[model samples]
Target: MPTTTGMKGGGYYDANSREQRSASQIFLPWLEAAIADLPEPPPHQQSWNLLDIGSSEGANAIYTTERLITALRENSDLPIWALFDDLPTNDFNQMFLNLFPTGKSVIPANDVYTAAIGGSAFGRLVPPASLHVATTFNAIGFFETRPIAVLPGFILPMRPNPQAPREGVQVSEDELIPFQKQAHQDLCHFYRARAAELAPGGKLLVQIFGRNETHSTGHGICDVLSDALLDFVEADMLPRFFYENFIFPASYRNTAELIAPIESERELASAFRIEQVEARDVPVPFNDAFTANEDRAAWAKSYTGFLRAFTEPVLAAALPDGLPQENTIEKIYHRIDRLLQDYPDRYEFHFISIATLLTRL
Candidate 1:
């Protein structure tokens, strides 16, 4: 199976991405403010390019880009070309359909042209100095490749499982240094790549699941999944190696980690000027509804479906090649469903997000 960092496709991500959409919406004002600050393109420039780097299935991206086009039009009639980019393995067909919902350019009336590019954003995918604005939402947490083969007892390197069988074998702070280094490296590479793509004075907005002083993203959801995987291992339904080797291909960085590269790296500091860096816990829609109605069953399913949309792709890819992938995925998610339903309080997810707005120098 091809290693993929993209979300689950077939319209699933777009359908079940309420949490992501909510978190992304929190930054819209910041994005608009950044757009307002954008310097007008040179006199010879033909059009402005707005790019979404990790636009999975293009639902949220389409809406966000349309708003951006509308915002830009308020100032100038610059024809805007909006680009949605993700992994080559991502469901580009679904993205395109969403990009042009009426079998034609939905935003043609606004002079907004849309297209999808399939590639890794960690590498340069667009012409140098050609982009005007770029945004990456809930995607920078993912590693370009699996950093480690085995992370005993926990899928997320930062969050340890207290109920793990090999208690002390769980990942430790000292062991996480390498992973921290990897996160730094990944961020730096991403910045360098965007630096090459964006014009001077271009705006870049980046938002990803993150950790704050008190809260971290995927708290309840990942913990429950880890417990379920441990249960599978104990039942001999899955080999111990599978449990140890399986890891969510993402990392949640704190505020310090998120801005370290620009603060410390000479090249990054010179290439971009940081406008804002903030981290906070965004409200979860299902969590809010559950808080009001106390509907365990509905909340459980909603939470699981939301998690599965972004996580199942990585989990399914990690299964042993000969195994029944679909059956295994079904079993794993079913267990998560049951666990959430039974002990709803055990997994209250927190959506901690870190966002930064920067301008190319």
Candidate 2:
């Protein structure tokens, strides 16, 4: 199957992924350090450029861009240009509104310039050798291909049980080998493009859903979502064709694999130095206020809502063409909620976050 970074409509991301604020903050220190370490450009050069990859619905954009502008101003008098990049179907209007929600710019208008760039990170999005800094957070998980058309019993490529495929999940190395190569290729493509787009001494900061080990990287969150989606099949809410062609549109890179491209690809190794690469395990909100009030139904509903906002578009797109009742989207989520309520303790997640800092050589 061809690849796609699943399209998201207005507000789907911000409303669901509450962790974006915290995740986006990870960019600040890296951005500031990169700016501080930047080589003195030609005396005549008085402007700098920054690119934000996969800026969904602008939640993280607001925090990161604000800090970015502030950081840029402290180091240089040069005006900074910020470019926000994502899929064409992403919410650009909401991003601008987020940056200037009160009809007033968050930073001095004369100090920094900002614009939205709509495109995939798999290929080039900016002018060659012109950028001074680039950042990507929680977005690289969305790969540009569907390596596995459908995992019969589950969706997560991050296996909790690595040695054996989960029940109902049909796959083989014959299928996974090529898919793994493709994911690595996609990552290499992203970095090579950055290497070309970044000026000498520039830096690229990346944070994506990934792991530090080759073992099963699966988390409770993945299980919850898979159970929810599979619950629909059990309830007969969705037909079999939906599952036959369905698969999650993400690729979670492993720890060593995160920077393998930079090491193996001569061009990448020549162009950038891996300043630091570390993985952190973050917790997911499970039986919080949503589950403590003794309202299991309410908790399930709320949890399902959270997942639905970010995933509904992709789920709906998987429906068989011309099928009716496909628009009963809430029913699917209801099924998910029902499943979650039945297994609240199992509805957790441990995010293995890979943070990497790269300096252009």
Candidate 3:
């Protein structure tokens, strides 16, 4: 349960998790397979335990948990006890309110039990071998704490290549290495924790934003925000160092990075068996909608809203301390929107989503 976007107000993710929907669509088939391939539980098993890590306000969980229950019924009619874990700051009230029309656990016919757990996903949330199936979305890669002070300059995670940048120098070698190591450590923690929580042969299905290649991560919207912040510096509205010192939280893993920890370490190597690892090219939400509705203005608005939901918390954390958060957040999005309107296609989101299916051993 990593800290979700937007620290203060709740519901940013619930309202604007467009990317999650798109990513989940791409992962639907795999999700089906993961559930279908689950090892049949022992005879007379009366109850099943399911965990939804980083379950933000319940829209995704309500649907995903239902899907899981439906699949589970195929094997046995045992009622499921679903645990939705997230940070304490999350809107659990909205979550349960949305699920139970009568504010009760029994969902008419489904009969699946549900509850909420609040904490960091980096640490263990449940007792060992307690969960039968675990699912997480867009929640991996975030460390409970900022590992170190932000790199000398740059508010977001910027890994400049060894080569030259046409406008300026890339993030130096010292800055690049630490950034990557921190991400790896965070990911290891995530895998190790899940390994312990899941029952032997339990299923784990997840969709994490990642890079396909080693050179760069899938920074579809992040780089755009970085450039937009730099534009503010150029426009003299915001200072240069604010742009320079902005360090974004979370990691974006590549395929190689994803496998390295599992294959290299003996204990972790034996923790789980990977069934599928897919690197999908996620078209920005508006780009796909634009082809259908064909409204540039509408597309621009959707794109801005998507970025605002997903990145606003990071933006808030990056801003200079004591700045007017509400107003400044608006200005940042407004500037980004203006840039998009000025040149409609100048920037298209470059996103690569990684979906993995593993069975805990």
Highest TM-score, which number? 1
Clashes of each: 0, 2, 9
| Positional deviation of residue 73's Cα in model 1 after best superposition, in angstroms | 0.9
Number of backbone clashes in candidate 3: 9
| Position 340, candidate 2: lDDT | 75
Top lDDT: which candidate number?
Answer: 1
Each prediction's RMSD over C-alphas, in Å, is 2.2, 3.2, 3.2
1-361 per-residue lDDT for model 3 (tens digits): 2434423235666776666767666776676666766666665666788898877777766777777777777776777788998888777887877677585654444657778998777789998878889888777755556665556444445564232122542456667677678777776887899999988889888777777654333343555566677767777667777876666676777777776777776887899888888888776667888889888788778778877775777677667755434477788888778766665654555557787788898
Task: Name the regions of candidate 2 deviating beyond 4 angstroms.
Answer: 1-7, 108-110, 148-150, 160-167, 170-174, 214-218, 283-302, 321-326
Query: Cα lDDT for residue 138, model 3?
Result: 72
Clashing pairs in 2: 3-145, 153-168
Error of 1 at 124 (Å): 0.2
lDDT of 1 by residue, 188-208 (tens): 989999999999999999999
